[model samples]
Target: MHGYTQDKDEYAARLRRIEGQVRGLAKMIDNDQYCIDVLTQISATTKALQSVALGLMDDHLKHCVSEALTEGGDTADEKVREASEAIARLVRS
Candidate 1:
């Protein structure tokens, strides 16, 4: 199983909340809300997503990576590389 398996429900709930935030953003645009107001909400939504990403990354390191390292060899190396690439993508976002 993936590292986030234990907290899967929590992640799903958080993603649902973020989904609502996105829907609200679209509604704000449809209703012609203030530019900065929309931007502020956008910033909040972005930060929420980043928070989830960070949590998942932490979980991966604590569980999946830890497990791989215990086994030792190419599997461990690949997991670390995969995690690094994921982190790079998160940072770029």
Candidate 2:
């Protein structure tokens, strides 16, 4: 199972909320809402997604990475590499 399995429901709920926010954003554009208001909402949505990403990264380090490190071999190396790549992507975003 994935590291976030324990909080799967919570993650799902959070994503759903973000989805709603995106829909609202689209509606705002359709209704010709003020530019600043729309940009503010976009910033909020981006930060919400970033928060979830950070949480998942923490969970991954605590569970998956720890387990691999305990095993101490090629698997550990791969997991570390995978995590580093993931972090890099997150940072770039």
**Model 2 regions more than 4 Å off:** none
**Candidate 2 clashing pairs?**
none
**C-alpha lDDT values of all predictions:** 0.98, 0.99
Lowest-scoring 10 consecutive residues by lDDT in candidate 2?
1-10
lDDT of 2 by residue, 1-93 (tens): 989999999999999999999999999999999999999999999999999999999999999999999998999999999999999999999
Error of 2 at 18 (Å): 0.1
User: Candidate 1: where is the Cα deviation over 4 Å?
Assistant: none
TM-score of 1: 0.98
For residue 13, give model 1's deviation from the true position in Å: 0.5
Question: What TM-score would each prediction reach against the true structure?
Answer: 0.98, 0.98
Candidate 1 C-alpha error for residue 11, in Å: 0.5
Error of 2 at 55 (Å): 0.6
